[model samples]
Target chain A: MAVKAVKRIDLSLAPLVENTRRVIKGLKLHTICDSGNCPNMHECYGSSTATFMIMGNVCTRDCRFCSVKNGKPQEPDKTEPGRVAEAVVKLNLKHVVITSVTRDDQDDKGVFNFVETIREIRKRSPGTVIEVLVPDFGGIEELIETLVRARPDIIGHNLETIARLYYLLKPDSSYFRSLSVLHMVKEFNPDICTKSGIMVGLGENEDDVIEVMRDIKEIKCDIFTIGQYLRPTGEQFEVKRHVDEDEFQRYEVVAGSMKYAYVIAGTFVRSSYRAGEYYQKYQESRKG
Target chain B: MKEIILPELGEDIKEATVSFWHHKEGDEVKAEEDIVEFYTDKANFSVKAQASGILKAISVKEGEKASVGQVIGEIEER
Candidate 1:
């Protein structure tokens, strides 16, 4: 295990950070920022942006790298979709992100909430661009089609790590299943931007990271984000090493060569970090 | 004269409501003493006086929103 030190915490976002906190609490919402102990929470929330964790905070699977609580899941909140849409209006967000813990225990696998949430966002704030980081839905084709029919701007399903580490890291998840999920999204509708992300620094080398990128590209992924994985709790997997800044830059260069439409790779770059900005840029380039 | 501005509370937060005031104009306040409390969208926070002095001015009252970098109050050094 490597000794780690905290770096790059910005103190300037305090005032706005308060606003975001108040709204999330008042609305009774759960965010990955709070659940995963995301380091960029302050920066993202203070900017009046957050990735809303829908379904419920309790996850069905015990992924080793994640900090979201795992247990028997609760009944899906029926009114959640409307409340999420209301939050978007109050925040006046131009780009909105919605993700969830894996709810494998539920029939339909909580797909209805996702569809309803997207519809509510569209009906309430048609101008706000919506992005969803969804589960694999047990590789169910009909469920993927149901979500695609709702027409979210971007659909993200994180592979989370290299193929070799899935058994140890995401014990219940299969690397092939995740790749097929990305492929299916494109298969369902080619226009929706398909995205995925992975975390490095868990004893994987640069080649391992690139191999995942190759798989993502082979599936015709539109956006790829890479970030350093910080151990969220003492009990989770210990950090093998913090991939240095030079290594991140090298990954960026290599990923760029692979021709991902948008490649955001950095130590602090979470999957949805500055997501709206990249989507906007991708839209502009498409016009040009 | 030391101007007391709302300090950075958290990331990307833009505005806060003046939840309450612990001090009023002409009250002597010690440096870092809680003078006002603010309500943000997510949480509540108490702000401190910049330096020990008389509370010379109160620019924002309770239940009002203060934008970041706004001068909320002024402290006249004793």
Candidate 2:
């Protein structure tokens, strides 16, 4: 294994960053950047960009690699959609990403919040690009179709890890089911850009990684992201090994050649990291 | 002399941190040449030189932050 790469997190609190925190707090909203303890929080908030975690902070599934709290979550807030839309307007965001904690307890599996959030954003900020990073929703066709009908500019559901390690990292989720989620999106609406992401350094080999990439690409997923899996806390899954920078570049090159609309693979790349920029590139590719 | 101002990055992005300077002061540069790189929270952008000239000064050193439209550097035109 290569020597671990030392990464730094900037702790500076710029004005915009402060304002972003203030807005989220003032609205009593949750952001994955804060809930997940994302390394890029400072920089992202500094630019007035954030991935809003709708529904609630608590998740229904206990994915070992995730840092989100897993347990019985409160009832979904009916007013969340409007507040999220209000945040988009207050921040003057041109692009917005809305994600949620998996809500298996809900009757519709939390698709209602996603649909309503999309509706609210469209009504309030018509020009802002919306991307949603969602869970598999138990791979229910009707639930997936409901979200598809909402017509977000991009929809993402992370594969998280290779098929072989699926039971280990995300025991509650199925690898084939996740792929089906992306496939179903394209089936319902080919025009909506579909995306998926995975984390490395989870004890998967290069071949395993490539196999997963091929699987995602085979589904005609428009965008793919790969990032190093940093252990958010000692309680989460341990980092099996740190993937080298060169290896990450190799993955990007390999995925790029596979004809993905956009491929971002690196140590710090997250599902919604640079999502707006990737959406723009995907749009440009459609034009070309 | 020509000033190199940080152009509008995108909607809602009002500032960025200087990541690198491609050339040192006194180095000749061509118009539209990528002279410096800036990184916002989400993405990286390369700012090009406005005119062919010698990179005379860098007002914002690396790792420092600058808002949109701020003059980050200057060039002495040929």
Model-by-model DockQ, in order: 0.06, 0.04
C-alpha TM-scores of all predictions: 0.78, 0.78
Evaluated at residue B51, the lDDT of candidate 1 is 78
Report lDDT (Cα) of residue A195, candidate 2: 88
Q: lDDT of candidate 2 vs native?
A: 0.85
Docking class of 1: incorrect
lDDT of 2 by residue, A1-288 (tens): 664543333322345667898899899999988777676776688789999999888899999988789999999999999999999999999999999999999989999999999999999999999999999999999999999999998999999899888888888999999999999999999999898988998899888988888898789998888998877666888888878889998987887687853678888789998788877877787678
The ten-residue window of minimal lDDT in model 2 chain A covers A5-14
RMSD to true structure for each model, in Å: 8.8, 7.8
In model 1, the runs with Cα more than 4 Å from the true position are: A1-7, A10-12, A285-288, B1-78
* TM-score of candidate 1 on Cα atoms, chains taken together: 0.78
The reply for model 2, stretches above 4 Å from the true place, is A6-13, A286-288, B1-78
In candidate 2, list every pair of residues with a backbone clash.
Answer: none
